[model samples]
Structure formats: structure tokens, C-alpha cells
Target: MASDPLFERLWNGSAPMEEWTAAVSDGAITAVADGIITVHTTYFCGSVTAIRTMEGLVLIDTAKPDTAQRTLEVIRSWDDSPIHTVIFTHGHIDHTSGIAVIDAEADARGVPRPRIVAHRNVRRRMERYVASHGFNSIVQGQQFNKPGYVYPIGQRQPDEVYDETLSLTIGGERLELFHGRGETDDASFVWLPERRVLASGDFVIWVFPNAGNPRKVQRYAAEWAVALRHMEQLRPAILIPGHGPVVFGEARALQMLRDGAEALEHLVRETLALMNRGATLDAVLHAVKVPAEYLAKPYLLAKYDDPEFLVRNIYHFYAGWFDGDPAHLKPARTAEIATELARLAGGAEKLAERAAILSEQGASRLAVQLAELAGAAAPDAPRIQAIRASVLQKAIDGESSLMGKAFLSVYQRQAQERAG
Candidate 1:
């Protein structure tokens, strides 16, 4: 379905933006007309930006190690600016691991290692990566499909750390850093006061905010909004994001940031209000809505992250896991429910037939629920195969968003496996 192009594209390798040109060239770097420099370090993983001043070349974030070599080559091609400082927006692997390449370049040229700076919390986050490598590998496998790829544990820790705010002058350029929590606990954004440019790492990914990754560590929705508001105050004319294309102009960038923040805040506030009133988790999830205004925004659409997940994240943030219902405290197993439902409906065959009827009548949500129950009840039944196909096709026809597309693909795979 159109709503879930990312999932479909991943499975089929036909994503619309897969070949879209990077705002920055591959294996090359360039300085913008505003004097801010940028490099598209990796296609979808990370980027590096720099600004030249009398003090030195101040870099914002680095690409992944695998991508860093090419990124450095690009940077060197653009300017011979001496690397005197590095500012890490966060401790995410893609943004920090590439420092080795930069270090090697400086050392080879007989220049001193650049001073690394980041938010104080970055140190703890890096330590957590080392402490939980196995857990992170497993989670990354699920999210990225790369199993057993051990992310490097030895991080290039920051030499300079700040708590709330820090200001510096790099090569005569004024740069200000502010701490704001978002996808990560130690997220920070850089504001260029004179050039009116902002290097927003991961905070504004051009697409939707990745605030509700189901498999990752806890994300900060409340803090994400706070960060956006802080950036809005800066009124930067040029916006260089962590991923995706760079946005030019102040008004458009601010509008995008404001809309995104408002969308997340609305979901968080509404979900929390319902939970505070003792509503069940399901009730709160269904009740929270992205305001009508943001639904049409191209950049805020549910392309990368779904809104339902965001609502669930908010619920977990405020109310914890219990749904305030005793029935779910130690609930019946899913298999138990499926077996009972199948028996009540006169076996899996009858349930499959009912699912087919419901699907034909455009009751896709109910049809899928019934089909799942029937499939689990009769794993090898021919009727189960039919029900699976019918339910998935219905979903593919009706669903929207990347999440829905992924679910449809998964169901189709299950149907094929059962048939075989």
C-alpha cells in the first residue's frame, strides 16, 4: 500500500527515494553559499558538516567507519582547512565511529589530534554500548537485518563535554551547541549564529522522527519536542540534517520542525491524558490522533515511523506496561485464545470462511484478526492458506504507511510457507 512504501520498497527493492540524489555529492564535500560545509558521508546512515573560522575547522559529527574513508576523501577535496575541533551531536554508532578516519588523516599530516566535544551524557551512552553489545546486536539484527555484526565497542570518547549549553569560535565562525533529548538521551544540535545555519543531527531527519522504533532503547518524545522548540528559536536559514537532504531557508525549515514537534506532542499529550483517566491501553491508542494539519505534511507522514507505535511509546512512558486491566495482568496465551475461538466458530474451516466473507465485505481489520486466529488454530489446513492469502491481499489493497505494507508482506510469506 502507498502508506507503507518503505516496507514494500525494502522487500521489493523499489523505494522511490532509493536513488534520489544526496544534497551533498558522494565521495565529495562542498561548502554552501552561506559558508557552511557539508558531506553526505553515507547514503542513509550518517553525514559530516563543518564550518571554517579563524580558530579552526569545526566539524559536526562523523560518518560510520566503513563510510568514513570516502567521507574524508571528500572533505579533503573540498578544502585544506586544518581540523582543530570535532563536535559530536550524539553517540550513535554512525555519527561517532568515523572519527578514526579523521584522526588518521590528521596524524598522517603531522597535525595534532582534533579536540572531540559532545554532550556529557554521550560518555554514559558509549559505556552502555560496550556493556550491552550482545543485546544491541540482537536488536540491530531485527531492525536492520544485519545479524551478528558486532558494532565496535571502543568508542572515541569526547575530550570536551558540556551539560546544557556550550559556545565556541572555530576559524572565526561563531558556533553554539545546545543539549536536547530526542531519539537518544544525549542528543545535541549546533547553531551557527553568524551564518544562520544549523547542523541538526538526527533531530530533523527530513522524513518523520524515529521516536517510536519498536525494537530500540527508550526514546524521548517529550524531550524531542523540547529540542525542536529550542531550534525554532534559532531561526536558521540553512538546515543540514543527520540523514536525508539538506533544507535551505529559515521559514521552511522552522515550519517543518514546528509541525513535526506539534505532531509528536499532540500524540504524547493525548495518549497520556487518556491513560491518566484510567483508560485501557487499547482505548488510549485508538483515541490519540495526529492533528488534521500534520497528516498532509510530506515530511511528517508515517513513512519511517508509524503513529500507532508513538502512541504506545507514550503510554509506556507514563503508565508503564500494565494496561490497568486485571484480565491482562497474567493473560491467557495467544494460542489458547485461538484454539477457543476456532472451536467456538465450528473449527478453523468455518472461521476461515467467515474471514473470507468479512474480507470480501471490506472489513479488513476484523478479517485479518479472524484469519490469524484460524491460521494459528489450523496451521496446516488448506482453508488456513486460503484465509491467509485473502486477508493479506485485502490488507495490501487497503493499507497505508510503511508498517502496514510490512505486515502485508509478512502475512503473504506466511501464506506461502503454509501452502508449501
Candidate 2:
């Protein structure tokens, strides 16, 4: 992990440096609220939340498959209480893959397996994951800058599925689960009314809510805002987010939730207005600017899903796949377009030379675009491949968002292979 310092930079963009250092220093299990302990992971994976109930432990979301053992150990250290229940905030791989670890632990202890609970749509999402396992693996590899990662396909089917809301009395403590469409259709937020604690799945991740993941399925931007607004009204005194640090006071929690919600609301409204005016998706993307105040908030950085992508998502939701450009509606093949551009630019060599010059001048995006054109025009050109790789590396270094860095790194690695 130390070899890739950019991961830390991108993940901890808005959070305090010392706080991040402290939280990640050995995966300490800290009490966010009374009887509620959280195991915050280092990267983008969801944090594991364990609530100490009278009967046993009630976990809200588990760590990724790779980090489950360590996270489980951290939870066990806090209390040896057998896990009585596990609630999946959503069916995202990182949050659900650890179920096997917990189930195994329960079996070894001679106790009944923990009852799993989630939104009804979780099974549908898991089925989709099963169907597109290979595609998901590839897309996540590009998204996480870890091409070698093997995403586990196995998941524990939820024992109990709820449609809208379900209040579960676990170990004599009440946990209110509300289904909300946010990052996923299977999203749920847990509210402990007695403790004034809320476990917001990916809905309240410190980063700008991931309502515009380019490769992922549909995200609920407007509905996500609505969910946040609802959570804000609940006024959780202690807010445990799916990722990043937990919020302490009700005021701070409301502020964070409201800010995130309003940001999405503003973006959605602005995008719809542009769409109503018959503006192109590209134009809408450029037109809808996130409010300066929201962008300036420490909890709402553009490190993950930026506002431009959110605008595009809104456009896609309302306007469909067509970007309103007649030429793009039935676009020519990329290679053919590149070949034409290369011909007009004199030759592939000239294009490669120009790309290299642009790369040297720090025009990384344009350099990469030109290099791609050159590579498409002449697939076997080593010079073009090298130029593309170099520019992509530069772009990766300059990128502040993890998504952008991942794409640039993957593209750069591919370019290097081609160059070789």
C-alpha cells in the first residue's frame, strides 16, 4: 500500500491528515456512539460497524473480502459477543463479501449463523453480479487501479428482505432500517432511534455521493438527495457512514447530510432545466456547476464522483443514451475516425510527434487523445504507444480523483504493454 501514495492522497483528500493517520494506524475499533464500534478501513472499502446489543452483536455492513479477517478480529477484540445479526446496507461487493467470514466464524463457535437482512432488491443486484461477474471484474479493475484484483463472486443471501422499512429488535435493541435508492437500488440506512445513531450506507460517504459512477449501473441522484433529506430530518446524533470517519454531533451530521443532499438536488435541478431547454448533454455537463460552498466543504470533495459526471448521469437518466448529437447517434468506428484524422494530419508519425510535443508541454488530455488517434491509425507503432504511455502516466499523476487516476493508470499500463 505504501508503494502507491496516490491512493492515500485521493482517498484522504478532504479529511484531516492527523485524523486519517490515527484512524488507519492499526485498524482500531473506536466507539462512535454508545455501544457502537466502527472499524474504518484505509481505502475506498466500506467500514465495518458493530453494535453491542444485549443478545449479542449486530453488524451493519462488513469489510471487503480481502480485509474481512482483520476487521472481524478488530470487532471481536471490542467484544467477544457472538454476532446475532448482520445487516447489509447494500449489495456492493466490498460490503457483502465478508459475510462468508462471519458465517464461518459462527459455525466454528457452534452458534447459529447470523441472520442477514437487506433490501429486497439486494438479491436482484447479486444476481446481476453473478451474471456479469467477468464484466464487473474488468470494470472494477479499471475503477480501482488494481487490474490484478479478483472480485469474489460469492455472497450470503439475505435471510430477511424488507421492501420499504422494517424495525428489527435485535438483542432487545431496536434498529430501524429504511430502504432508499442511492448508490444502488438495494440501499438501506439503519437508524437506532434510542441511541440516535444512524448507519448510512454509501449514501453518506464523505466523498461527493457516488451518484455518477461512469461504468456502474444506474445511480439515484434525485432519490439519493431525497433520502439524505429524510436522514437529515431524523437528526442522527451519531452518524456512521459507509466510508470515512463517523460524524459526532447532530448539528454536524445534519449539516453534512443536508449539504450532500442539496448539492445533488441543485445538480439534478440544473441538469433538468438544461435538458428541458433542449441543450446537449455535453452542454449540460459544462453548465451545471456545483455550488461553491458545497464544493468547499471538507466532507464533499470531488475526489470520487465529481459534479460534471453527476450532471452527465442526470442527463442520461432524463435524455437516455442519445447525447442529442446526430453524428454521435450513429458514430463511425473509432479506428476509422482515427485513420481519417491521421490522414488529415499528414501521417500517424506526425500525429505521434505532435502528441509527444503536447505531452512535454503538460497538455496531458490532448496529448493522450492525439496519441490514441495515432495508435488507432497505426496499432504497431512503438513511438505512438510510448507517447501514449508517457502522457497517460502524466495524467494519472495530475489526477486528484481516484476514478480518474484509475483510468489513467490502466490506460498507461496497457499502452506500456503495447509499446513493449
Candidate 3:
């Protein structure tokens, strides 16, 4: 019941953009390795890897909260074996929130609840989530364009947490989990030494590593590269990435890991080089670039994250938040500054007009900034609000990364409502 060829096409770099993005969230269960099945979940979420062991099944990732039931159904359709354990690749809500549903399902089946596994920091992250539920809900709403959506905070926590490595034998198959800091500080990647299969959490996603997610907390660009390169050394014959299609064959799998690592390593190295030379964050952001060679491979596409964001992330961990600009260190209020600029520029209408012209000329990067200033200067101006909404949509249309587009959509919707 799976078009396994889709995975093959992705590995070979022949899958068209249309077909590729569609399969990104397709819940189709495909047997990628001998006994391992990969079931992708919704967009912006990780994939569910169901590994059938001798005694029972070992599931790596339960997917986001909304996709939990569907992921469970697919796994059950493939194998009725009781889930012996559920290993979370990380504590990201998109990957860990489904634990509650999974645990309830086990209880309903009259089976022992599977042990939920993760890194020790995962528990810490959950604690932070509990303490900052309101903040997270607002962030998630802006991120997913769910204006009034509330983030589910009652999800179950991991029962088994490891600091470094955890080895488990389920159904006679030994699965090795190695901890690494990637998209999040608490991250784990599974390795099947016998099968040469690697379940790399978000470390080897088939897109630019999300080392620079703008909305999230601290991320490790250097550590993320180290993690991917470490997995490459294992020479995994099959790779089930955290968010994209599975990669079969040793060369294909290694290529994905290597390419992703190389890009992040380049960003980290370049950002550090500039920072060491006393360059500003803005300067380093524009100077560092992803070698064009990686673009040839579809797996390294910047669909989920941007290289510029990764550069900024490198600057974040190495250098302090100061952008090396005296003006930015103690900037005046944004609205006040916008109002002043509008006064100097003749009015908010002129700023909106320039922004519209810039957007039409494909200067979305500049246009969006101007539009924002216009909106701040004239928050109740219908004409300014309309122009700001259009400019925001233009930026969203031109954006190639999902994270950037999602945040832009949130603002655009608000602008539209004000304009109406």
C-alpha cells in the first residue's frame, strides 16, 4: 500500500519539486529497511519510523499531536506487534507531543505502556514548556498561522531519559541511540549496527538543517554538523531522516548526511572567522554562503530552513546577542522611530507607497521592512494597512523556507484584518 518508488526517486535527486513536497507529509507506510517502516506525518513535523523487532516493535518518533492517531493506524496496519518502546528523536513538540495519544492507545489495548525514551534535556524542555505554555501558544500561533490556536501542553513526558547513549534489545534487535545537539539541545539518533540503518532525528533532514530557526531558543550549528558527520562515519546503508523521505543505499544515505554537515560546517566556520575578525552579525550573515555544489542535490534544498539563519545562529552561540552596532544596543522604541521616520519622509502614505513599489520590483526583503515601519507609524490607516498586507504576502510568496513563510503569514493575516 506504499509507492516506495517515491523514496527511490528522492535519493536519486530526480523527484520533481511538485511530487517531492507532496510526499513530505504523506502518511504512506513504506518498508525502507528489512523490518523498519517509515511513515511521514504532517508538514513541519517529523516522521514516524516503526521498527519491528523480534519480541515487539520499537517506534522512533510518534509524530506531532494531530498526526498521532494516523501514524498509529499506519504502524498497526503494517505490524500488529505491541510497541515495545517509543524513542523520541528530540523534545520538539512536533515530535514528542504525540506521547499522550500513544500511551492512551496502549492502555486501551490492555498492553503495557511502551517506555518513552529521550535525552535527559528533553525533560528539562518539557518543564520549560509547562512554565511557558502561554508564550509557546502565541509563538506556535504565529508560526502555524493559527491566530487563536492553543498549544497542547498536557502531553506525556518521557519515561526513560539518557545523557549520552542508550542501547535496547527489542524483539532480539539491538537499537543504538546516540545523543547529539542539533535542531535542539536534546536530540537522539538511532543506529542499527546489524542492519546498517540510521534513524537520524532532525540532524539529517532532507533540507537545510534548522540550525538557525529564528523563533526557537539556542541551537547548535557546530554541534549539529558534528552530529551529522558522526553518523556518516557509521556508514548507514539506509537513513530515515526526521522530517523527509527515507534514503536507501549506503552512498545515498552518506551523501545526505555529508552534504548537510558540509553546509552547516561551512556556515559555522565562516561565521566564526568573521566574528573573530570583529565583524558585525549583519556583515557575517551576508558574507557566509552555502557552496553552490550542494544545491545540485535535492536533499540539501533550503525548503525548511535558510542558510542565512544558520549563519546568525552560529553568531548567537559564539558571540553574544550584540550585533556589534552601538545604535542597536540601546535602540529607541520601534513605533516611535517609525513615527519619526514617517514624519521625515512626508507621511506614512509615502512609506507605504515606496514599500509597494519595492515589492512590485521584487525587492521583498527591503519592501517588507519598509511596510512594517509604515504599519507601526500608522497603525489605524486603512491604506497603510492594505499596503502592508500586500507587502507581507509578497514576502511570503517569495520565501523558500517554510519557517519564514509561516511567520510572515501570521503578520499578513493581522494586517488584512486591520485593513478590512
Every model's TM-score: 0.83, 0.92, 0.93
Runs of candidate 3 with Cα error greater than 4 angstroms are 1-4, 12-26, 41-43
lDDT of 1 by residue, 1-420 (tens): 022344234223354344433333455453554556678744466768967666667778888878877877777776687788989999998899888888888888898989999999999998998899998876665455454567687877999999999998766777899998888889889988877888889888756687877766778888898889888888888777787556667777798789878988888888878877889888987788887668666566566677777777778877777977887999998778889988988898888888888999998878888888888888888658877777878887776555556546665667867867
Query: Where does candidate 3 have its weakest 10-residue lDDT segment?
Result: 17-26
lDDT on C-alpha atoms for all candidate structures = 0.77, 0.84, 0.85
* Models ranked on lDDT: 3, 2, 1
For model 1, give the 10-residue run with minimal summed lDDT.
1-10
- The better candidate by TM-score, 1 or 3, is 3
Instruction: Score candidate 3 by TM-score against the native.
Output: 0.93
Clashes of each: 10, 0, 2
TM-score, candidate 1, is: 0.83
Q: Is candidate 1 or candidate 2 better by TM-score?
A: 2
Give the clash count for model 3. 2
lDDT of 2 at 42: 64
Per-residue lDDT tens digits for candidate 3, residues 1-420, read 244676667666788545755765546776777788888754456888888887788889888877888888888888988888889898887788777777888898999988888899988988888899898888888776778888877667889889989898877898899999988989999999998989999887777777888888989989998998999999998888887777778877787888888888888888888899999988888899989888667878888778888888888898778899888999999999999999999999999999999999999989999999999999999989999999999999999888899989988988999999
